[model samples]
Target: MDSGGTPEQVLMGGSMLIGTVGAYLVLGAYLVQLQHYCLAGAEGKRKNRLTLYILVGVVTVCETLRVCFITFAAWRVLVLGIGQPVLRQSPAKTAPSLHILGSFIALFIQGFFAWRIWTHKFNKILGAIAVLIGLLTTTQLIVGVLTGVQLGRIGAIAEQAAVTAGRNGVFNQFINNNQNPGGLTPFAISVGILTSTVFVCDVLITIGMFSIFHVYRKRSMAPRAKSALRVLSINTLENGLITSLCAALTLILYYARVHPWIHMAS
Candidate 1:
């Protein structure tokens, strides 16, 4: 109904679809884990229980914010259809801030991976580097989101629904304005650093894990055990590659500026 460009359509629709599916998948996993823990009489050590609770809090907050974003977007569309000026005046006002939730989720998840790698007794230096990378990237992501939000609120960048009307030319013009208050250089630099560091961290973890698994497999005598380890290694490698690819793609789309919404959704 908005008659937006292909890129805008893809971004809006893709975000809706992903948000729905991702929420379900993530919450479903948490639900299953919670059920199992309950059935086991919550027998985990105190430290483990504390960690689980903290993680649950993080996931809950993230998912709740995501739902709010989806709801707000849908409401804007509906209001626009009904011929309201409110949406046009304050389009996507909350989205940039809300999007920071993704970075938080990534931080916690990546920190968990780092912890796992540390538990394996990998080189202490490498483990420290991985943690540092994760922290830096996450911090950069937050800064980028906040910067973009500041720009968006100041009219430096168009809102979510603004592009939906196929007004990309206006958006481009804003970006090109020499005296524009919100310069994109900082946001671009932040995203570049975050994505690069995240990719590097994931790669290091995957390689370290693979090498450890390979060593174990060679020493393993049981055929069944070796086969299981092979499967695990493959899964680990695939997950790492997928994460790296996503970060790379997000960075490309962002720097290229072909479709900023696409990168934001990523």
Candidate 2:
């Protein structure tokens, strides 16, 4: 399992988990605050607050799913041992698909919120970037699922061969040859590309967030409104930063060939 890799790797993985958890918790709290503020406000602001609630709900669900996927991947790695066939169809392949789906949901929610804020230019720019990233991520997920299905079929054939041939036939050769190949599959390449795209998307989101915060600061809203926006901005920035750090760690592990379990779980 490369447990002996540099201490940095261990710390990085632990920190990634902590950061993701913390970000989600803060986001949840911010949503609750929004709900309270919305209830206290006049009828005119209630509609906007309801929209924010829906957007926050979507983000919460997406992030929760993402954490669940990561946790499952880690659990599989621990149980199966590194490089073992954790899935007949390969969970490594399936994980990216979930990630892509979650990313798209998050993008949609964020775009909706940006639009509500009436930052038209920032909304357009962020929307475009989010759409591009979401498309690439979804493409990668589809590719991974297809590759995993093919590998599963091949594994099934090999297993049947072993049973019929008594372990000393072409089935052994097939199993040996298909032992993931270190980095030869389209799935692996797609994962790499998706990881890189995530980094770029994170950068753009950060910029958009900062721009939004600047606009919020210049407004002459009530103190409560100002405080709410500040809280929202802080939570959003933390979430974006944590996501980017995790993506970067996964990207580094992929290229270093340190084994997929360093990023995946089983």
Query: Which candidate should be chosen as best, given TM-score against the real structure?
Result: 1
Task: Give model 1 RMSD, 1 decimal.
Answer: 5.7
Backbone clashes, each candidate: 0, 5
Give me the overall lDDT of model 2: 0.52
TM-score of each: 0.65, 0.54
- Report the C-alpha displacement of residue 152, candidate 2, in angstroms: 4.7
lDDT of each: 0.58, 0.52
**Model 1 Cα shift for residue 142 (angstroms):** 4.6
Model 1, 1-266: lDDT tens digits are 24443444444445444544544554565566557656655664565767767786776678667656755655563345235432432335655654466667667766766666667644666577566756765675676567556546544345443556654343333332322334444445545666676677677777767766776788899999899789779977886787677667666766776544333333
* Residue range with the least summed lDDT across 10 consecutive positions in model 2: 168-177
Compared with the true structure, what per-residue lDDT tens digits does model 2 show for residues 1-266? 24753443343344434444544564565567557656656455555666666766766676566666656655443334235432322333345435454446545644554343344345566566556655654554565455445445545554455456453223223222334432335435655665676666666666666667757755837888778778777876877787688678767866665444333321
Return the TM-score for candidate 1, rounded to 2 decimals: 0.65
